[model samples]
Target: MTATSVARGATTEAAARIMARADELGAISSRADALERTHLTPEHRVAADLVGAWMREAGLTVHEDAAGNVCGRIEGLRPGLPAVLLGSHIDTVPDAGRYDGPLGVLLAIEVARGVRAGALPFALEVVAFSDEEGTRFASALSGSRALAGSWVEDWWSFADADGVTLADAFTAYGLDPGRVADAARRPGSVLAYLEAHIEQGPHLEDADLPLAVVSSIAGARRFALTVTGHAGHAGGTPYERRRDALVGAAELVLEVERVGRSSGVVATVGQLQAFPGGVNVVPGRVELSLDLRAEDDASRDAAWDRIRTAAERIAAARSLRFDAAETYRADAVACAPWLQDAVRTGAQGAGVADPPVLWSRAGHDAMVVAGLAPVGMLFVRNGNGGVSHSPDEIVTEADVAVALDAFAATVAQLARRLEPGDTSTAATDEDRAPEAGA
Candidate 1:
C-alpha cells in the first residue's frame, strides 16, 4: 500500500479509538464539582495516574515525573526523526467541567495508539501536565512552566489562599517539591506540539461550527490594588466631608470596565475586600484584584497602564491613598502558521465542517510549549456560550469526537513528514533558559 493509503487507514482507526475513549472518560463522573473541596487534591493525581495507565495500555512507555506530569512515548520507525509532543493539563479550576483539560491528554494517547497499530513513521509523546490551574499556588501553569524551564524555584515558597505553600502541599500529597527541577524537559527534543481543547468560549457554539483552530493565546496581567481613606460613623459623617474607600474602589472598577470596552480589550475586577466590615461604619479601606488581558503584549501593557493611571487619579481626587502591584503576567503566544494549516487540513480530512481560526482569551499549557517547538491547537464547541470553570460547562460527545478525529489526522500527517535529523536539540542545552509561563 502507498504511504497515503497507510496514513488514511491510520487516521480512521485513531478517530474510532478517540471517540470510544472520550465516551469512557466523560462517563466516569470526573466533574470538577466533585473535586473542589480538595482543590488540587489527590483526586486529580488519581486522574493523572489513570491517564498514564491508559497511555501504557495504548502501547507507549509511560512515566510520571517528580512534578507529577505524566508522559508517554512511542518510538519512531526512523531513529533520527524528531518527536511530536501532544497533550494538555489534567488539573482544573474549582468546579471545572470534565472536558476542559483531560480530553486533550486522552486524545493524544489515542493518536499514539493509532500510530502503534498502523506502523507510523515518527516518535510521539503524550503528556498529562500537572497544576495548570494554579489553584493551590499563586502561580498558574506550574507544570508546563517547569518543563519549559520558566518556573522559579523560589516560587515553591508561595502559598495558596489557605496559607499552604506549594512545598507543603506537595509533601502532603507524597511528592517532594525539591525535585521540581526533574520536570524540566531537555531543549529541542520536540519538533512540534498540538493540543485539543474545549473552546471555553461561545464562539464555536454561536457560529455552529464543530471545531476551531486557535490563532493565538491572549497575554494577561494580574494586579492587586489597595485604597485607603478616613473612616467615620456612617450616621455622623456628612456625605460631602467623607473620603469613602469603597467609593474610590467602585469608580476604579467602572473605569477598568469602560477602558476595556472602548479599547477592545478585556478587564475584570473579580475579587474585592473591605476593611472594618460593618454597615454602620464607613469603609476605611478596600482591596481589589484586577485581571487584564489582550490579544497582544503591547495592548495588554497599555490597558494596565491606563487602569493604574485611572486608579491613581481617582484616589487622589477622593483624598485617599492608592497602590497597585502586579501579581502575574503571561505574554501572548502566536500559533505557528504551518501547524495551523495542518490543523485545518486535518479537520477537512475528518469530514468535519470548516473550522474557524479564533484567538483564545484563556491561557493553556500549549502556550508554554510553543516557544520550544512549532505549536497549534484545536477547540471543540462548548455549550452555553462556552461557559467554563463552572459545573454547568458542557460539550457534546459528537463535538469531542470531531475534535479527536482532527487531532489524530494532524498527528498522522506530522509523523509521516518528520525527518530523523530534524529533531530539535534546542531544548537539550543545559544552560538554555526556559521562557516565562511556557
Candidate 2:
C-alpha cells in the first residue's frame, strides 16, 4: 500500500474510535446530580480517583499527586520526546452539566486509544486536574495552578461561606494539604497542552458552527463590596435624614452595569446580602460580590477601577462607609500560535465546515497550563445558545463526533511533527483563522 493509502486508513480508524468512545462515555451518566451514588463527591479526591480509573482502563500508567491531581501517561515510540498534556478537570460546581469536564477527559482517552492503535511518535499524558470549580474552597484552578507552581499557601487558609477551610476539606477527603507542592511540575517538562470542551455560551450555536478553535481565555477579577450606614426607624426618619445602605448599594450596582455596557466588558453582581432584617427598618449594611472579566488584563483593571470609583462616590453621597476588597484575579491567556494552527488545520482536514477562531470569557484549567507549555483549545457547540453550568446544558452526539475527529487529526499531526528527523513545517497564522463554509 502507498503512504497515502496508509494515512487514509489510519484516519478512518481513528474517527471510528473517537465516536465509539464518545458514545460509551456519554452513556455513563457522570452528571453532577448523580455523583453522590458513585462516591464521587464534589471534592477533589473523588474526581482524582474517577479520572485515574478511566486512565487505567485506557491502558495508561495512572497516578495521583500530592495535590490529588490524577495523571495518566501513554508511552510513545520514543521515550525522550516531550509529552503532550491533554484532559481537563473532573470536578464541577454544584449541579453542573456532566459534559463540561468529562468531555475533555474522555476525548483525551480517545486520543490515546487512537495513538495506541496507530503508530504515533510522541508521548501523551491525560490529566484530570484536582479542583477547577472551587465549590468547597474559595480558590479555583487549584490543580492547574499547583502544576504551574502558582498555588499560594494563603489560598488554603481561605474559608467557604460555611467557614470550612480548604485544608480541613482536604483532610476530610483523606488527602494531606501540606504536600501540595508535590504536584508542581518542572518548567519545560510538557511540550504542549490541548483541551476539548463545550462552548458553554451562545456563540457557536448562534453561528451554527460545529466546532471552534479558542484564541484566548479572558482574565477575571472578583471583588467583595460592603456598604455600611446608620440604621434607623423607616417611618420616623425622613427620607433625607435616613442613611440607607441598600440605596447606596443599588446605585453602585447600576453604575457597574453602566460601566460594563459602556466599556463592552463583562461585569456581574451575582450575589448580594442585606443586613437588619425587618419590614420597617432601614438596612444598616449591605454586601455584594462583583465578578469582572475582559479579554486582557488592562481592560480588567480598568473595569475594577470603574467599579471602585462608582462605589466610593455612591457611599460618599449617601454618607455610608464603603469597602472594596479583591478576592481573586486571573490574567488573560492566549493559546500558542503553533498549536492554534494545528487545531485549525486538523479541523479542516476532518471536514468541519468553517470552524471559527473564538475567545473564552470563562477560565479553564487550560489557562493554568498556558504559562508552562503550548496550549490550545477546541470547543463543541452547546444547544440553546450554548448556555452551560446548568442542568439544561446539552451537546449533540454528532457534534461530539466532529470534535473527536478534529482532536484525533490534530494529535496525529503533532505526533508526526515530533517524529525523529522530521522537519515538517507547522501551520501558519493565516491557516489558524476560520475558513468560509461550503
Candidate 3:
C-alpha cells in the first residue's frame, strides 16, 4: 500500500479508538440515566484517573494538579522546553453528550501517541480539565482558570445546590486549596494552547463543512434580574389595578430578544421564577436570568445597555421595581491570526483546500487558557443540526477521522513554525486576545 493509504488507515483506526474511549468516559457519570461529572466531585476524580491512564499509555508523564486538573507531558527536543498545550475538559454539563468535551481530549492523546521522541522543539502536554461546565457550582472554567493562574479567591466561597462550598469540595477530592496556585503554569512556559471541540452551533452543519478555523469567541455577560411589585388576590385585582411583576418580567424577556436581534447579539432568558406561589394570587416578584453574548465586548455591552433601558421602561410602565445584578462576565477572545493560519493549513493538509473561519458564540475553557498563552480552536461539525449539551448531540466517525488528521497536522504545523530562527512562533500584539468556544 502507498504511504497515503497507510496514513488514512491509521487515522481511521485512531478515530475509532477515540469514539470507544468517549463511550468509556460517558459510562462514568454521576447519574445512571444521564451524564454528569462536575468539578471536584467523585465522578470528576474518576474521569481524571481514566484520562491519566490513557496519557500514561501514550508514553506521557502524568500527574493530577492541586485543582484536580489531569495533566500529561512528553518532552520535546530537550527536557523542560516550552510546551504546546492540547486537549479539552472532561467534565460535562448535566445530561451532556459524550463527544462535546471528551472527543478533543481523546484526539489529543492520539496525536501525542503518534509523536516520535525528540522530533519537536517543544514539549507536548495534554490536559483533561476537571471542570468547565460548572454543573455543581455557580461559576465555570475552574480547571482552566486555575491552570491559567486566574483563580479568584472568591471562587472558594461559591456553593453548589447541596450547599457544599468549592473549598470543601476540593478537600473532599483530595486537593489542597492552598496549593491551587500550583496548578498555574508560569509565564512563557507554554508555546500555545489548542483545543478541538464539536461545533455547538449549526453554522458548520448548515454550510456542510466538517471543520472550521474559529475566529473569535464571544464576550458574555450574565445577570440575575428581580422584578418586584405588590401582590394581590388574582380574582379581586382588576387588570387596571394590578402591579404584576411577572407581567413586567415577561415584557422584559421579549424586549431582551428584540434588542438582541437588532443589536446583533445573542440573549437568552434561561431561568425565571415567581415568588410566593399561590394559585389565586398575583406574583409579587419575579426573578429571571439574562445571558448576553456577542463577538466583542463593546457590542455585547451596547446590547446590554439597550436591554437595561428597555427593562426600566417596562418596569416603570407596569408600576414594578426592577433590579439587575451582574453575575458572570467574560470578555471576547480573538484567535491569533498565525494560529488560525496553522489550523487552516492543517485542514488543507487534511484535504480541504479552504477551511471556513467562524466566530464562536459559546464560552469555552480555551478562553481562560488564552490568559496564559496564545490559543486557537478547530471545530468539528456536529450532527443533529448541531445540538449539544443534550443527548441528541452527534458526530459521525467520518468527521472524527478527518478531525484527527487535521488536529495532528495543526500540531505539526506549529512544530515547523517553532523551528530554529522561525519568528512566526513569536507572540504578537494580536495574540493578546483570548479564544475558542465550548
- Deviation in angstroms for 429 in model 3? 2.7
1-120, model 2: which lDDT tens digit per residue?
111211322344544554454344334443534431111234444445655776787778888877777888877665655578888876666556667777788778766654562245
Q: How high is the lDDT of residue 349 in model 2?
A: 69
Candidate 3, residues 1-438, lDDT tens digits: the string is 111211222366788889899999999889999998787788877888999999999888999988888899988878999999997999888988999889989988988888765667789899998888887886688889889988878888989999999999889889899999999999899888999999988988999989999998889999999999989999999999999999899999999999888888999999999977888999999999999999889999999999999999998998999999998788999888889998898888887778899888888888989988988999999989899999889998888988888888888787777776665554676686643332
| Candidate 3 similarity to native, TM-score | 0.94
TM-score against truth, every candidate: 0.87, 0.84, 0.94
lDDT of 1 by residue, 1-438 (tens): 123412333344555555566445444443432535222466666676678889999888899887778898877775544577888887766655667787788777776766653254556788888878877675678778777766767777888877888888888877787787877777667777789888888988889988888888888888888999988899999999999999999999999999999987889999998888888888999999999888888998898888889989999999999998888887888877767877888888777667789989999887887656667889888898789876567766666667767777887566545533556332233322234342
Instruction: Report the Cα lDDT for residue 266, model 3.
Output: 96
**RMSD (Å) of each candidate, 1 decimal:** 4.0, 5.7, 3.0
> Model 1: how far is 134 from its true place, Å?
1.5
Error of 2 at 67 (Å): 2.6
Query: For model 3, what is the C-alpha lDDT against the true structure?
Result: 0.86
User: Clashes in model 1: which pairs?
Assistant: 80-420, 81-420, 186-427, 187-426, 187-427, 187-428, 188-424, 188-426, 188-427, 368-438
User: Stretches of candidate 3 above 4 Å error?
Assistant: 1-10, 434-438
